[model samples]
Target: MLAALVPLPVILPLLGAGIALMLPGRRRLQTAVTVITLVVVLIISLALLFGVDALGTQVVAVGGWDLPYGIALVADRLSALMLVVSSIVTLLVLINAVGQEMADTANETPVSVFNPTYLILCAGVANAFLAGDLFNLYVGFEMLLGASYVLLTLGSTAERIRAGVTYVVISLVSSLIFLMAIGFILAATGTVNIAQLSSRLAELPPDIQLILHVALLIGFGIKAAVFPLSFWLPDSYPTAPAPVTAVFAGLLTKVGIYAIIRTETVIFSESDLRIPLLVVAGLTLLVGILGAIAQTEIKRLLSFTLVSHIGYMLFGVAMGTVEGLTAAIFYTAHHIVVQTALFLAIGLVEQRAGVTSMRRLGGIAVLAPGLSLLFFIPALNLAGIPPFSGFIGKVALFQSGFETGDWLIYVLIGAGALTSLLTLYVIGKAWNLAFWRDPDDVEEPTAELVEEFEERREALAAGKAWKAKPSVPRTMSLSAGAMVGVSVFVTVFAGPLWDVSSRAGENLRSPQTYVNEVIGHGDGS
Candidate 1:
């Protein structure tokens, strides 16, 4: 029974996507199908999480072919947890999108295009998490890239199209590199199955192993947006519609991070890439936050901070210890919720004010107290304020570094600390400029900014700016509020979640367990 549940997370969304596509003109029915599919996925993911914890790793070989040749879907603690969180995030973002469509008659994000593509994106994410082979993971990345291209350029505006082009080019380059790495792995080890590669990789020459490992890292690195490879993200992500941006900010890059975690822990378990990862983590942190401090637009700032916090997850991975992996898992979960919530909240700001530039936004605290509260909670949470999950995750990661006692890790600890402080400063600056000040005192928008805003408004709906309601739709606010609540739930349940993360971390550090479950049993027991 538990084994049967492993494949549904990927299958159901795909089925729903097809069904949604068939119901082209029935927006209500399409939404019903999409919601029911995701809600079921959420329940199954929660069951998988508990089942994996109770029953140990669950693996299902597709079509009953034996491992090393057939495709396999495996769910241990890490993948199951990711599935649960992702299901939750995707469902809420969908709700937010539905609300936006209902409220905005201009059809900024057409339901016909959005629903099916979004479901496909969810299936791709599930596939990536459950993929037990390198080639399958590449397929998952392609699924995401294909869907994201359509979603990113939804408006067909010149600005969005340009950003989408840059995004597609960068993503295609990364995908090609990933495909090459898969070929190299297959050529070198005679297998691209992760479990088999685990043992076979160790037998190859050290130099060959290092080359394969670095190739894989570079490919995944570009996707994860680790600095240097991160320049495309800030520009690409900020141009999408609010719900699209929210989901992308929250989930997409993390898929790359997840792949990197699997690569470091399972395939190259003995390789010592720790020091280099640490240096990269430090640079990622400093460089990303520095970029955030320089941004005036709310979405752009959040985008930079998104890159900055990826550093924390990378920092935890660089520690290369069970404690470190645990913290990385926890931080990944926390960042996903907090970051998605922040974007949704900012989406509300954009909807209400018709702009997200801090210089032009003010008095939101008085005008829209609810939106203010939604943004305030996640902003503080993202900055690692105490009593929130962000703080809890950061503290756990810092503790893991301290446990390592390496001077370089010590320097990273300092970098993480500085990054946190600067995050707070930037969040504070945005709050003061956009929320705290009186509307009358806000700076007037420049002609260029006004022209851009007008273009966007017109793109969203030809002339609806004059006819649309001034107040934000309640559904949009509720969706954002629910996301904020989930972030809080993570904080309240930090203890149990940490314990689960620790177990997942322990499982990751012990590659033999994964191998034994997938290959040793041979029947996918």
Candidate 2:
């Protein structure tokens, strides 16, 4: 079972992709495959979590070759927890996308686009978590980026195309950096195998190892959108379709953070670089939120906030302690749910009010009371108010950072809290402009070319024909409701998830165990 488990995450989806390709074009089949795949992934992740909890971390060498001779797949608490969280995010958001099409209800924005690519993306992510070699992790990342390049531009609207191109270009550059970094690692250690590198790494002198670690950091840093490298994120993410935007917001970047956490713990644990990471984390948090504060558009604002929160996870990673890492892990899980909900809710609002531009939308409360409430809860949750999972995550992260009694961390925590407060204010600004203000005063849109807009939207909505809309489709409302419901679950289930997250943190801090399982007990032991 353990040997088989190593391949399940990757194998299942590739098989599903084949099935989806052969099935048909209805998209219903695609939805079925995606939902089932996500469910299976969730179960596998949970199984891995509990299995680790009970027996211990496990690894399987591909082709049954010995360590340093073949690829490996590893499952530990941290990876398993992330797998489950990401699976849920992807599944729910994909459903949200399909639900918006309204083929069953009224003619919506005229399309439906949930299918095999999303499944392939999920498969890629699962493979990333399970990969026990550096090159394999790189392969997983490339697979996902390739799938996402299409997803990001699913609608092919000019704005989305422009944003998608920026996204692809930036990601390609980062991928190249990652590849070069891998080459460096391979050169230094003569193995692309992660477990072997771990043991071989300790044998190398400290100064030489630091060089390799720096290269990896730059590579993952680009993906993590660390500080200066982060500008691409806000630029590219806001323009994707709703479901694509939501998944990108919630799941995609987290993959980067996940890689960061993995490499920092698994590959660079011996380096005295936590302080540098801590500084970078603090800057990312402050800068990201501050950027949000300046944005007038709802999607752009959310993008900024998203950048800022990445800091919390980095803080946890930098702490290098079990408690700190656990807090970060917990926060990561919590954020994924909340972020997806927020983005989906915003998408719903955009569809209902007929605009994503905050300047153009107003007084949704009059027309969409339920929608307003849906939006409010997630916004507040993302702002980290009490009784919400976001709050719990922030508290855990802050507490962990403060425990170190490092003034820098103290400052970072204080700033983080302030950013949370202001995140509330900025989102409130959007809420105020979009929902609370008078609706009647909304100037009729001057979209003389909106018919063309509908035509393209219809095509991207899955090649369905749709007439110009006098009214918004109800399916958008239903999709929003489903997404909001998931957010509520996160707010409610903060306890059990946190427990699992803490265990993940503990497991990650003990990387020796991960290696032992993957490569088997080594001579060093």
In the range 1-525, model 1's lDDT, one tens digit per residue, is: 999999999999999999988987788898999999999999999999999999999988887688868898999999999999999999999999888883123346666777889999999999999999999999889998899999998878899999999999999999999999999999998888899888899999999999999999999999999988999999999999999999999999999999999999999988879999999999999999999999999999999999999999999998999999999999999999999999999999888888999988876675667788999998999999999989999998999999887999999999999999999999999999898876557687434334444554676686444333346778888999999999999999999999999999999999999999999647532
Q: Which numbered prediction scores highest in lDDT against the true structure?
A: 1
Q: Counting only residues 3 or more apart in sequence or on different chains, how many pairs clash (N, Cα, C under 3 Å) in candidate 2? A: 2
Off by over 4 Å in 1: 102-107, 445-470, 523-525
Global lDDT scores for all candidate models: 0.91, 0.77
Per-structure clash totals for the candidates: 0, 2
Quote each prediction's TM-score.
Answer: 0.94, 0.89
For model 2, how does the per-residue alpha-carbon lDDT over 347-438 read when each residue is reduced to its tens digit?
Answer: 87776655777666765665566778888988888888899888888898888877887888888888788888888889889888777876
